[model samples]
Target chain A: MTLKKWIKTPKGYVAIAMFAFLIIAAIGYKDSHGIKNAFTAVFAGVIVDIILNIIKRRKWTLPEGAVITGLIIALILSTATSILVVGATAVFAILSKHFLVYKKKPIFNPAAFGLLFSFLFFKTGQSWWGAFGDLSVWTILFLLVGGYMVANRIHKFPQVFSFLGTTFVMLALMGYFNIGDAVDALRPPFINGTLFFAFFMLTDPPTSPAKDKDQVIFGFLTAAAGTLVYAAFGGLIYLFIGLCLGNLYTYLKKRSVSKSMVNRKGFISTHR
Target chain B: MVKMDKKWVILCSTAVAAAYTSGFYSTETQAVKMESAQHNQISLHTKVQQSGTTGNIANYALNQQNKKAKQKYKDGTFTGSGMNRRGDIQVAVTLRKDKIVDVQISNWGMHYSESDVVDLPGQVIQRQSANVGIVSGATYSTEAFTDAVQDAINQAQNS
Candidate 1:
């Protein structure tokens, strides 16, 4: 799709909304570094995506999804991280989308995987500054408003709703029980991080299930996994890890179903 | 019928196991550090008394730590660095006799460690105590902040 037509798609709106929220946050922090990091990630992500796409398909394709992934990765990084780290992360994210395919589609959210692996590799900060948590309580308005627009456009309400509702209530329970002060995760960066993940990344079209029932299970699994990881490792990487786990579940279920069909038909590799 | 994905169950369980292991390690290390800090403080108290030192902030602070339960840092600007596995938290503090006049953190793990700094300095100045609790969810930052502050306090006490 042309850039104009592409922006009208679901991914387009999400990307633009995320970028807008980021700018608003950068302005609020009065730190140009945030904007710079985001742009660096985007530039790097787009370039890598285009380069890889050309190599694979022998035609040029705009990196719409990669752009969104880049922006999310940048926003989640510590605003103080170097541009080189941000660019490296963006490149890795695009690479995952290009090479980590299960069946002509990547099985993980590129942004989520990029952030998770980048964090594991670099051990840098994940301030999640894009949520504008440092500014003021009223700033949640930006997340709510923009997130609503994206989630509504994509029609992934079931997944988003389940993940968010379960995450909040479960985190509150963790807080009530005083698990890692997990209830604290319901505040500031964590809350914003959860909401952003729910409304944006968790709804990744290719990796997530669309069926209402599966979506609910996937969402609950993601939250359960996230809480478990957070209570254990006590870092911000839990969200991405949880989502990846959920993606693994989906990919496995699909594979298992296909395998069963192959076995019944007495044929090898029937699904493929 | 594969009612549920077996791989899903496996991955989820594995994540839980890893989380538990990490949490256990973090808590154990924290306990050790607390014990060490307390142990060091007790031993240092005895040594300072035997030395019959006058105008030593550690002695006065210990007396206060027992009496008012904590305060009386020395006057001057001192820097302290708290080390953890991930990195260190370095803080520069200015004190006026028994009161903390100012605190500016120079480096905090170079990353998410600032979560601890959000309101910690203000709290340190307000309470005038480095024994203040850490910011929830900012454990690394909190430990580093108090550790570095205590380090600086040690410098102030000795000098």
Candidate 2:
């Protein structure tokens, strides 16, 4: 698709926004390897996506989804991660996108799934450098603005707001209570990383709810589970684990809805 | 079988609360142990310094001369720990003839993979200094590792 046409789509706009983030983040990176790692991830994502599409006999299209996933993985993973590992993560993310689907939609956020995989298998570090976690706190404005634009384009404001609100509220309560390592989440890099995840990953349409009510519930569950995990385990995987749980909920909700619809159709046919 | 009903909600809440309480207690206990260890080390160092100063003039001169002849690091194995937001890293350093002969790191908490930084122990040994320059992407883990190594060096010098 042409640039003008593509810009009108949610994926295109999000991709552009992510690239903008990558630019700002790379400029602030301490060394030259930051951009190279990102490139490796993107390259792997594109190649794997195209190959999968071919195997599935789908029409050739720009791998926009894969690109976004690659960018997210690159941004969240530590810049110190080896190039091979970065590439492998992107490949795993794209593969999960193709395979881990229900009714033609991914059941989990590919980036989050792949990141958790890397963490478990490779012990990869997460610096959230793309979110400008390492940079001065003022740089968060860019993330906020970019995130707002993407969320608006996707009409996921409800999910984004609820997640962020619940997270901060939970964190504040924990801090007030002097809970286990809860105060740390309120600090610079953790806060930045949480916002980045809320705005970008939590707002994934296929894996999150569309209705405002369900969105609110989903957000609450995600934040609660994530914060609880953080409080209990105090590890780097809490956010991703929380997100995966939310995805599971969404998948189940969709399954039940479809089941009810099928039963309703059968009853209508019998009555007719 | 997961349900979004009140019963499920209550059950999950209770479980979460229990986990949080347990975690809080565990963390508190660890913090107290760390603090106590630090306090004891400080007290011991002060006592040693005070004892050295209270000796006779001739003994003090002899001790000074002996100290000047002593190596910067006593050959032995020493262990130290470094902590960061993600976790604590413990390193065991071995010194032979005032050179760092070996380093072994144990990271029970979340940190970078071994491949993330190429041969961190080798770097420490090659440089013969705890101030091995920061690895670009693994700054936190590097800092923690270097801190632990430096802590071990401090112990070696004190010994």
The candidate that achieves the highest DockQ relative to the unseen native structure: 2
Q: Please give, for residues B26-120, the per-residue lDDT of candidate 2 as tens digits.
A: 44545566557546654644664464532122343355577876554578999877656544568888987666788888654433455644577
- lDDT tens digits, residue span A114-138, model 1: 8877777775557777877566878
Q: Write the per-residue lDDT of candidate 2 for residues A115-154, one digit (tens) a residue.
A: 9998888877799888887789899999788877787677
Evaluated on chain B only, what are the TM-scores of all the candidate structures, in order? 0.54, 0.59
Candidate 1 Cα deviation (angstroms), residue B4: 25
Distance from true position, residue B18, model 1, in Å? 31
Candidate 1 Cα outliers beyond 4 Å, as residue runs: A1-4, A263-272, B1-159
Q: How badly does each model clash, as a count of residue pairs?
A: 0, 0
**lDDT (CA) per prediction:** 0.72, 0.76
Q: What is the C-alpha RMSD of each candidate to the true structure, in Å?
A: 11.8, 8.5
Best by lDDT: 2
Report how far residue B87 has shifted in candidate 2, in Å: 4.9
Chain A of model 2 scored by TM-score: 0.97
> Could you give the fnat of all candidates in order?
0.02, 0.13
